[model samples]
Target chain A: MSVTAPKGFKASGVAAGLKTSGNLDVALLLNDGPDATAAGVFTANRVKAAPVLWSQQVLKGRAVRAVVLNAGGANACTGPAGFQDTHRTAEHVAAKLGGMGPGQVAVCSTGLIGERLPMANLLSGVDSAVRKLERTGGDDAALAIMTTDTRPKTTVVEGDGWTVGGMAKGAGMLAPAMATMLCVITTDASAGGDALHEALTQACRVTFDRLDSDGCMSTNDTVLLLASGASGVEPTQEELTEAVTKACHDLAQQLLDDAEGHTKKITIEVVGAADEQDAVEVARSIARNNLVKCALFGNDPNWGRILAAVGTTSAQFESDELNVAINGVWVCRGGAAAEDRSKVDLSGENISIVVDLNAGKQTATVWTNDLSHAYVHENSAYSS
Target chain B: MSVTAPKGFKASGVAAGLKTSGNLDVALLLNDGPDATAAGVFTANRVKAAPVLWSQQVLKGRAVRAVVLNAGGANACTGPAGFQDTHRTAEHVAAKLGGMGPGQVAVCSTGLIGERLPMANLLSGVDSAVRKLERTGGDDAALAIMTTDTRPKTTVVEGDGWTVGGMAKGAGMLAPAMATMLCVITTDASAGGDALHEALTQACRVTFDRLDSDGCMSTNDTVLLLASGASGVEPTQEELTEAVTKACHDLAQQLLDDAEGHTKKITIEVVGAADEQDAVEVARSIARNNLVKCALFGNDPNWGRILAAVGTTSAQFESDELNVAINGVWVCRGGAAAEDRSKVDLSGENISIVVDLNAGKQTATVWTNDLSHAYVHENSAYSS
Candidate 1:
């Protein structure tokens, strides 16, 4: 139950012989709509990918009919030719979808940047996916966009008379600004462009934005939401936002769980900050610290590295007032040693770290993964 | 030749029980005064160690008689008690040196943070070091202040009629705003306090300030310059600065070559930027990127990662006009793949990366080490 769990949506995935392994690398999602409303978020990186630039322009129309994604080539930094390839790919998908205009289609790609896509293979695969589009193909679509991710990530949230569903793919190069990920979310609730944008923004701000598996922000991160009012149930804005956020949170958790070479998933909860922004900043700083992540991998409750990372941030907190707890044990209190390090158990796959800034009432939680030898191996050998 | 290469300086290193390994963990550098003009730079970390705080105050007096260093504990985040320990250590060293004032002593420590120093063992070691102090003890003094360093780092610069000699120790937790390092530089030049301060500032601005080993800034980074004027050579401010910068650059290069768990030394040169600040910013962003570092470790000419990193900075550069070269191969020209990636060889211990923005004429170079599994292993297992 994923993107297709919502009404008026069909998805498919197929191998295009583009990936060297001959794995499924092409995915398509279609909105069979009486009314199509869309919203999207793209990478904040200044060097936007060709597909991201194309999709941003397409979303300006506030309507979308189809989404075509390929994983064998990222289609980024390929100059004007890259943008032309994206335009042709979108137009091809629109033409194959029975008279839909090019402006109604979105194109996304992930993999090696600075390389041209195999247009023949990608276009043929798009046609195959459009022909095989089925109501139960969401899982396959999720599996298709992955690079180094170990599993497909999909989630569905059911409302009283509406549904929201999503699928996301990413592993390495996962940081804020949505990571090196491609996400497709669908809803069957009656919503306009403004409502869709508001809901998607609110949903992603606390969900996908909080997952920082690594400190590397990608050049090709995109998340799109398509709403088809075919269900005839007009949900309120609050209800739509809640459902979308829940679905996104579920999918984001899956991404972290399946992140490359990670053995431990850490939930960093920063509390007692001056404000939510301060909490988020402090949490992000701690989450991105390689030394802290390495200690997490070794299961060595090293709170000193945690404090050292926090010190680097401009967040509100007195050095001596900070406290840290790992796996339910307060390892540091008042910035000094508190509980016994031996009391902290890190044998489980999930690690909980609580940092009390002791400044104010605001709080935030960021999710991250530990730095492991396998992470080094996967990334170092990835391009080769 | 090192810190002792300069006249009017005597250095010594002694083993203290502070280290469980019973290695040399204490060092003393005494400036024989005809004029003890001093200037120093310290870590920018807000959560500074007690010794840093003490040394900052000492530098304000523009005079220093001795420098005491320990390696077993950082004496950071230890609250007022840590400050008291640093204060007492300074006073003890000053007392043993024939009634020198505590304000004339600058104390430095590098090791585990959030721990108090063992006062009894540290003071005893200071006495022992003073008893063994000699003019030729620079190498021993360099060796004493090491935590995970593989070898002692020392440099000497011979001026027209004077000399600048220095010793530095740091292996990890090194970044701009100084590193988790400690250095003592002694010069036999005839310079006043203001000239010493200006020369030291100018020297460090381009030398120690440009090394970003890991993105982590330390709490105990301190660099001190003591001018004895014993050689009776009065050099120009420019000449003094050039010699000091050369000495610092030599030491900085040594630090990068001996960085913790690194198999290769990387020099990131960002040219054609709008200004030196922009160049430094762009270079630092690329240097700190884990993906780029990983690619370097694998000897992969992944210019895409370099471009992705440059995109994240606010540095002036057109997305399509950026160029990157690995070693001497222009792998990327005009932000697109130009040369064959296989032609770039990374078999050597030194790797040079050049990124051209084509926006201006300014340039900057920063040194860093690649991310390795050993880095994670050493840091994770360090505290345990």
Candidate 2:
């Protein structure tokens, strides 16, 4: 099944006994003669899934017309058998696409790790999926990527001379330093595979890797962007870059907003840092902190924990170089709170923080959320 | 005031206007005689607090008569002002102790970081505390170190020759790798300062450092053990080591059990690793994963998340060398579960996980809990 969105990419989704819920588990996206230029991003985690391995290997110097993705069993850590499952899935897709080699088709799977695929059900599912492809089946492809995601995530953005569309699935947080999330973007722009690759990589770093609500990187995370040039409009480099970045930022935000049990989104802005890297190092560390997360939940405006969290990092801005702001109000400066904390409203469900390191000009903003009881409730409940 | 406990040491607790709660915030313990045989362990985070700075410099080559502690504000990141507060706090305590000098006392402050002390109230609290010294105020002193802790944490382990007493406070996991807690231990067993220091260091490794919960190390974290020699009998080297080790282990467990929002404790046992460190590295990486934490929260038995988490570490174990078990039940081996998840339950709040490296005999156990909504609620609602 396909996890891509491209013009002429007719897709179909079906439930073939892969998931116990009997929900749509197989999705196939097919491209006819005018195949869109393909660029994909796979998980950065060193331990790759079988399908991730297959896709990464396949996308090296070739363009693909289809992608096959299944939900229920992540073909990871299953050793040789896992690799075979990916190969077979690729072969099935390529064969269905008029005898192309398995190398032309990418595959992705997400679900319980360390499990084998029941070939009987999967093969039947693939056949059924291919037979029902349609030109406007973007909605069906979205259903195929669901694991624990409560809702299907899709985004369509229209830009000058082109349109950028995408979908992502991740119920929990993906660490900004490469999180656990599977994203697929389709753009009808006239660009070569290499250009799409560069755009996709650059876009993934700023868009997908900058979000760290829970700091959990999944093994099966993949983001594939297929540029089908079906729109017949050659967009400028600057416009393509901007459009890609904007879409990625939008998708990342949507994922954070829809993160399981997320009640409030907290923005951690690190300003005047020694560099963008250090600023990010400081802000993201605070974002991933469990105590800081809890404090946000309590809306206590416990700035002390924020300082403490920053102190934990290697970036040492002199104590005096540190200035902290909550929301739009400057609460702390020159190392301590600027005003009486009793007047600050830290109890709001939505929290914003800005920390300035009076050392440099580079700044970074990180999106996170307060850790809450509902988070525990949803996570501790039985698996679907 | 004093921060000591002796067979005959007197202690007192008083309110210092630092904490808005108006609860007991200052505590002092006095040995009353020559008790220079002391040892300490401090936070390894490099970013040291004022009291930690003072104590490390003073304790470098001197002995002390009392330990003075305040619970409201941590004099950290206050630039030169923070150091001044520590000096004044020590001086005030010394003055109240009649002929004692500032050098004869030690001070500890726990609460908001980057805040200045209310000098007037702090000095007054010291004076009042000195006048009300008694031998039974150890418990109250324990309460003074609390920040968001749900209870007073104090442990007294009576051994053959002396009593090893300790008090610690960390609602959010204290920093480990250095020390993630403020533990003041008092013992009557006779031992040299160097010997005591040696014992404390050796005992802390597996006990304190191994108990990595939230993995955030505080600037003010310290473990001070004082020997008053009130027992009149010097302990053997072996006996001293055993006592300190036991005390450290017991307190570490307590900290784990009291981890914030943790309804159940999960023990990750990574066995058969190539080496002990490899086993530990793999386990620690998993322990820090929020997705695994949430998965544990859900009781989903998503061993894939566990495998994915372990694989993220720098350990040398290959997928083939890895074997994972949860709650004494082997779920994933040779990279995948047995394809029978019917008995698996990811819905329970209390869960256990064990990962086997299957390559060597060395094993490491990491204690952690699932991330919960309560954790979020408390952190987000904290003071600004």
Candidate 3:
């Protein structure tokens, strides 16, 4: 029970004939509530999809009665027709629910870009999903948004008097799928629209934003948060943020674990930097280096490549004073060889690399995956 | 003849037992001239190799008598000891040449970093190379600096009365062989230290610097230009710069052709940009996208990935006005699907991609290699 775990929420998943595999490709989440407030974040990329543009317009009202998501067609780069498709879907969802308009609905789509959505099939699927909305339909809804995801991802966090639950789908980690990360988080906390927006912003900043699977930012990345005051328990904004962050963190980890072709989920931590920004910059540079990722894949303690990646960043650090540790073994100390590299064990699913700049007291951590032959093969095989 | 094609240069390559394969791994180039004025460019990476540091110091003196190169170890990140080893190598070369100080001899090494060079074998090899130095030894010198390189790269540009000859070795394109690009250029033109420095900078900026194979900047990238003033003709700086640029362009292209595991040489051109800087930045961002490279490897005209890469850059461009052409076929126009993508042919070894921002009148070009399975296999097999 992903989104339906929250109070006063119902969902359903239906087959829309959008996916050639005949899988469930359309999902709907409805808030039958006394209060409906929502917040959303989208991809920073300038080339956004049609659903993203429509949802951004919907979010300006700060109230969402329902969300409609589909897989198999991204509806991106399709010009004005794509936007019209997204708008018509929202209008259909609103008409299915009495006393609601298109402004109260948010839309999301994921699949191949430069393709038109099958509006007839999708609108009929929306009607069928509304007829089948139930509390137990969240699991199917989670599975419906999957493109190449091997498994559905869901998480729930229990607060003292409120609950936060979410579902996410993305498997482009080691596969050639479009890998458009889409997530819908629901809560029964008594919060206003402004408070919900603030909470969601703070939650995603440390969770979803820290992930760099392939360094490929998509044009259709979206995360939505909806709150219904059905619990009747008013909590502080900080408390709500804490619970939401926990749920998002758990879901993001699931995405990383299910990333395509990745064998090791490596975590890079940078410490002793001038500030948080510098630390994050340094960590991101190391996490994105293909050479370092390849070395990790080979289980090789090649600290020189890590330092070389760090040198490319403008982060504050003295080259001769840097230190790197692989899997808790300090292989490089003071920018030179230290412990015997052969002693380090890398035959595990998780690897940790720590870089100490010896500059100041600031730190950051980033998560990434190793590059493998499987990754190259999957990504180059076809256009996902 | 490579570097020795110039009028006042002598070169020799010798086996130093540094390479496990017992191949020629040491090279020497001597400016046996009445005048020896030189300039050099080192890697922009802050964590440079010891030899890069030594060579930068040699260039500060504005004159070079000889250069020693090895291909078994890159003395990088080894602390002060690595610097000492580089200094000792330069001193050995100076002593072998007679009547020269260590400051007049430059050192360049390319191989695995974080290791020490074998001083005993390397010093003996220096003596042997000096004894065997001849005007026709340039080919041997070019072949000596091979780590993963399949063949030596040599280029010569003939001016009205002067000549520029260069030799380069780099195979880090898809492998982990340090990818340290080293080039030694010799010119018989009459040029001073300042003129040579200016010319070398301009030539490298548009040639070697524009090639981003795998987007990994090495710690041991060095390009040295030596002028012996052997040709009595005094050409203007513009004339000398044109010749040097031609030679650098040829050598940079050769390096791309010989890049590891690459089947296609891709040229990404960004036109109608806001400025030259923006054009170059946009071209580089696209060239470095793993998804874009993988599509090229598969011979698929996936224009969405290209536009997604462009959206990530800070360059100024309207999303709806961007146009991309693959192999002269306008696959995407005004950010929407245009001509038939299937019509674009990518089966050839050379692929051209053009992006028109339609914003301004500036242009830039970047060359890169497609990411292939062989690249992943080669890079992840070992820590070369």
TM-score for chain B of all predictions: 0.98, 0.93, 0.97
Q: What is the iRMSD of the candidate numbered 3?
A: 1.7
What TM-score quantifies how close candidate 3 is to the native fold? 0.97
Candidate DockQ scores, in order? 0.75, 0.52, 0.68
Worst 10 residues of 1 chain B by lDDT: B172-181
Model 2 alpha-carbon miss at residue B202, Å: 1.8
lDDT tens string, model 2, B55-169?
A: 8876676466788888877787666778888998888788878666788688887876767888899899888888888878787787777777887777776768667777777
Tens-digit lDDT string for candidate 1 (B12-79): 99999877899999999999867799999998887788999999999999999999999999998788
DockQ leaderboard ranking: 1, 3, 2
Better of 1 and 2 by lDDT: 1
Docking class of 3: medium
> Which wins on DockQ, candidate 2 or candidate 3?
3
Quote the positional error of residue A22 for candidate 1 in Å: 0.9
lDDT of all predictions, in order shown? 0.89, 0.75, 0.87
lDDT of candidate 3 over B156-248, digit per residue (tens): 999888889999988773211222389999998888999999899988888888888888878888899999888876689999899999998
- Chain A vs. true chain A, TM-score per model, equals 0.98, 0.94, 0.97
Model 2, span A1-384: residue lDDT tens: 222343555777899898888999987766553645677776666667898888888778548778888898888878887899889888877787675678778888887667788988998899999888887777888887787788778887777767887777887736734434777777777788877877777877777877887776777888887777777877777777777777788878878878877777998989888888898899888998877777666666667777778877877487666788776777678776576666667656668899988888888888887667777676656354
Native contact recovery (fnat) for each candidate is: 0.62, 0.66, 0.66
